[model samples]
Target chain A: MKEYKLMKGNEAIAEAAIRAGADGYFGYPITPQSEVLEYLMAQKPHERTGMVVLQAESEIAAINMVYGAACTGKKVMTSSSSPGISLKQEGISYMAGSELPCVILNVIRGGPGLGTIQPSQGDYFQAVKGGGHGDYKLFVLAPSSVQEMADFAKLGFELAFKYRNPVLILADGIIGQMMEKVQFFDQQPRITDEEIIKKYPWTTTGKTPNRERNIITSLYLEAIVEEQHNRKLQEKFKRMEEDLMFEKIECDDADYILIAYGSVARICQKSMELARANGIKAGLLRPITLYPFPSKQISGLAGKVKGILTVEMNAGQMVEDVKLAVMGKTPVAFHGRMGGMIPSPEEIVSALKNKLIGG
Target chain B: MTEEIIIAGFGGQGVLSMGKILAYSGIMQEQEVSWMPSYGPEMRGGTANVTVILSDERISSPILSKFDTAIILNQQSMDKFESAVKAGGLLLYDPHGITKHPTRKDIQIYKIDASEEAAKMGNTKIFNMIVLGAYLKVKPIVKLENVIKGLQKSLPSRHHHLIPENETGIKVGLEMAEKIN
Candidate 1:
């Protein structure tokens, strides 16, 4: 039966991870997102679903554990805040290069060296443009609500295994800390050892004499071989564009547009309403997948709209992407707040007027 | 109908829990709800506040700069949130330690001595419930039976016995709350 309950976004993610039939959860605690680990520990999913939940020594260790568990073709995940996520970049890059499937949740806090525990979207460039080294990209999902926080757990794992790549749920502290009513899907049974081997032929599950041994490594000594691997990964990323997801609010008759994601998108919705109420026709474009960004749809909208205002909780990162998508067709302006500050609806409306509508 | 509420007080005063219960009650009544708290270090005996929005339509933002109703439990919260109430909205507070009462004439102001009432009841933890009761008395957004159901939903089964006491507190608040503006 589908159950409806009021839950914090972080708690919903943890509960969804269990219901999604995740094989293991390895993570270290951080503010705003610590409840993810706390809920899992308090619930003890291992007793219910035979899942493993571990509090690793550190963030780096936790991500590495995810990488190791993922190699065995089992569903694995790890979550952390900004500083903790930074420590896991090396492992993320290795997982990307190795073509491993794993889910990583980053409930972003203010950055540039442990700035604050408050919400911020400063990690946009790092999450979408590649924080880790090498020609690699993570399938990034940005959830704006507690219900999405739960739904994306299953979706993230599905996308991860679909392309054998790392998937990131780039959430902020606001979404992680906020509470809302959410309807939870029924629990899914965990995959068995036999099912894992049969479903994933590439898995290194005690290689049988009938098939060749599986090797999981990011290291390629030869330059040409590494080039081939990079090309294959690039092709996979190109195909991921098919999964691009976004939401458009009142865009058909809009003269101006507000582009935002995650928590900022929620604020923009109100700003759009206020703008419309004040005789200014404004719409909102919320990109749910930050990596496979809705560039094509934005480019199309750019032709119809007079200007676009990009709002974020950081010092203008996603605005660059908006500018790229618009490609000079329309003027794209940036309105942002840094150090964990959130922009109010009135502030965003004023910015839209001043920057886009010419106050 | 949409009601944006800001409930502010100290950490131990059950400010967040009160907001949680209100949110659960909204859910029980089939209303869209969002609860965003000012989390982190401020939760440690310092001033803490939660923004709860209950709407028939989908809620846009969980965070807000203004509210239709402001429930202030402390002087710090009063000083910060008194003006945050929208013009002609509602301001409900407990004037326990407030040296300066609300001076706003644009909005409706009401006072409930929930702290004193909780003390008389010999259960300081129910202070927030009394305040919640007062808000319900004034706003009556959610039904009284649903508030009890919400209390049951938020509190664990072990604490189910306290539901009747909380209901009584809400009734007392309904009787004691007086419009001052």
Candidate 2:
């Protein structure tokens, strides 16, 4: 029988990737999330699980390596923090344009520049809004806990291959550095031949697959053909928007709702309690899927609540969506802390009392 | 309801180990739990911290802002988190390390000499467990049976021999904290 052990979040993500039937890991190390690379070095997946772990020359090289492996119809993954993820974006855009299925993990750190190695949710916009180029979405899964770190990828890789697209595990330094219980198990290969053939019958492997040669190219001779592809990507995005998940806490009775996601949810929860204690009727709404964005849930709460106040680690990535969902029916406000400084519960309460409640 | 707690202290004081026990017992009580330690640079420093969030609900964020309670092994920790405690929050301090009681009268303060208590038990390392035991005595969030199973889950397979000392430490703190209350 498999056993349970306390593992740091980065290590858990690495181990989970292995068990999810990933054929290879290509990554470059950066702070806070360095343990992800370090754990792969220790697990020695190459010798044990028939998995290949490559230390690429840089983030660009690593993501392109993922593109190469995914072309072979293998489950390949690459991981980096914010700055490194920024470097990988060009390759990610290329992967998306070519419809090459792969997975990327961004254990986010503070940013704009080579920000501090501490945790930050600054990359929300980057992950959801196509950081690299040309209208694409990385079916992003924002996991707030270590158990989710262990559990999210098996589903992520499956979805990547299903849609023939890239999937991202968006986590923060706090989730990366913290340790929690993980249950280990062996599972079937994540990418099956039948599944690949169902979509990409023209996978680039040893010749013998299809009669004619197949070259995956993102370039289009005419702008009209390129516009067609862009419209298709927009349709996929709309489909994703319809299927999103979020955690709703006490929103039915709340006149003022606290909107936050990722690590910021923890601070928001405590703030909600304090707000309620201070005679402000507040609750919390946390979206698990950042890109799909739980807009429908927020839309439902629009008429029920007086307002929605979005809290985030960055200036305001999610607040824009809160505004879109509320549609100016109820006021949508924002409170934020950046550069690795976490906002205290008192600060959040102050924002609520001063903004949502007082108004 | 089960709560997830994160207790952070320096390496010598057993923050990781205490967090393990909290998580182990938390699972045994049929609660969803995670015991996360401060890894990387923080672990090597003069201070350490862990965040444990035990909840009846499916936990969304492993990070914690206000814990239902906090156990501070040192005075610096108290200063670091004194403002984090909510009104009616519980503070457990080792009298030897932190002497300044919180100014707020709304919270419950349990002052114990965990180091001296561990000395009485003939083991200095169990000072962490003494504070842990007092936590169980005061909070009673997880059942005693779950705490035992949690020990089995946390300790290495070969270190099963040390389980007895760990239990004694918890029992001592429980007995002592019960007397104080």
Candidate 3:
């Protein structure tokens, strides 16, 4: 039987990680997301599932620990807020370059620097556009509700291993702190090393004297070899783009559309209803995966709607993608509230009217 | 039916918890509920607030600018949230810490001396329950029985012993709440 419980998003993610049979969770504490680590510690999941939950000295250290565990072909995860995620970029880049499978959660707060601890989608460009150096991409999932927060934790691990790449849960402070009903899925036991070896024969789990030694490193200093490696990564990125995920609300025969993700998407949902009630034909296109952005979906809506309004908690990041997707087929406008402030539904409605509807 | 509410007060005054209880009550009645709180530095001894929504259908946004009801517990919250109430909406406040009462004429304002009443009952911790009871009296969005069931769901088992006193506080609030406007 499925059991439902009212839980905070951060806590839900923590429980989901344990239930997903994650081998290790290494994270540092940060506001608006500390509950992930706090809940793990309180639950003592290590005793129950034999999962290692470690509080690293810093976000950098935590990501490195994840890299170490992931090298063994074990499912591992790390979580932090915006600033901490920035600190983990170097490690994340390394993990991506090595093609290590891991999951990362960034319960984002407002920032250009050490900004407010309030929720913001300011990290959109950093997350989807790749904050780390070199040519690499993370399979980023944007969860709008607490239920998705839990579900995505499991889904992220699945996708991570499937692609042999790092997966990111790009959530905002709103979803991290908000409380809602969540139904946990059935528990999955941690995959054994033998099973992992069969799936990923190129893992560094000690030589079995059967095949060539597996070397996991991003350093292909040779020019021709480096080009081949870069090309491979690009191919993976292209394949990732094919995995576009999105949700459309009232898009059929709508004149105006809003493109949004994460918490902003939920707000746009309300704004759509308000606009429809006011006799304005409005719809919403919510991108669930930020990196593999629902560009094709947005393109389909471009031909149907008069204009696309991209609403976010950041200044203007994802709007660029929306514009690229629409490709001048439809007018694209951007509205946002940066630095820890969330745009209210009424504000979004007004923006839709003024910018998209030409009111 | 949908009820969008904002509950605001001091950090330790159970403002957020009150909102959680109401959300739980809505869930008990098989309604959709979302509880979003104002987090960060403002949570440390300063004014804290939560936006709660209960609807028969799906809740679109947890973030709302205007509210059907504003449950104010202190002067700062009263000042900040009074204008946020929709016209003909309900604004309920406790008279304990509020110096400047709500002056909005379009909305219905009510005052419940919950702090004084809870103090009189010898346990000021029930202050929020009293205020919640008064809000329910004004607009019974959820049944009182469901609210008690919600209290059970929101409170940990260790604190279950206090439900009887909380019920009493709600009863007192139901009787004492007076509409000021």
Per-model TM-score versus the true fold:
0.99, 0.86, 0.98
| Model 1 error, position B104 (Å) | 0.7
The Cα error of candidate 1 at residue A67, in Å, is: 0.7
What tens digits encode model 1's per-residue C-alpha lDDT throughout A128-203?
A: 9888999999999999999999999999999999999999999999999999999998899999999998899888
| Number of the top-ranking candidate, with lDDT as the measure | 1
lDDT of 2 by residue, A1-359 (tens): 45666677888888988889888999999977888888888989876678899899999999999998888789999899999999999999999898888889998888879877777889888999888988888888887767778887787887787777898989887778776667866755555666755667758765655467778867887999999988887787777764477898888899899998766786688788777887778889989888888877898899888888999888998899888877888989899988766677778888987787785
Candidate 3 regions exceeding 4 Å error are none
How would the docking of model 1 be graded? high
User: What digit string (tens of lDDT, one per residue) describes model 3 on residues A1-359?
Assistant: 46467789999999999999999999999998999999999999878899999999999999999998899899999999999999999999999999999999999998978998999999988898878998888999999999999999999999998888999999999999999878899889988888988988978989777788889998998999999998999899889876678898889979999889999999999999998999988888889999888888888779877888999898899999888888999899999999998899999989988886775
CA lDDT for candidate 1: 0.94
Q: Give the poorly placed runs of model 1, Cα more than 4 Å off.
A: none
Stretch of 10 with least lDDT, candidate 3 chain A: A1-10
lDDT of 1 by residue, B10-69 (tens): 888989999999999999899999999998667765889999999999999888998999
**What is the CA-based DockQ of model 2?**
0.34
DockQ of each: 0.83, 0.34, 0.81
Off by over 4 Å in 2: A1-8, A40-48, A179-186, A190-199, A221-225, A273-283, B2-6, B36-44, B55-65, B82-89, B95-108, B116-123, B137-140, B143-145, B171-181
Question: Ranking under TM-score, best-scoring first?
Answer: 1, 3, 2
Scored by TM against the true chain B, the candidates give: 0.97, 0.91, 0.97
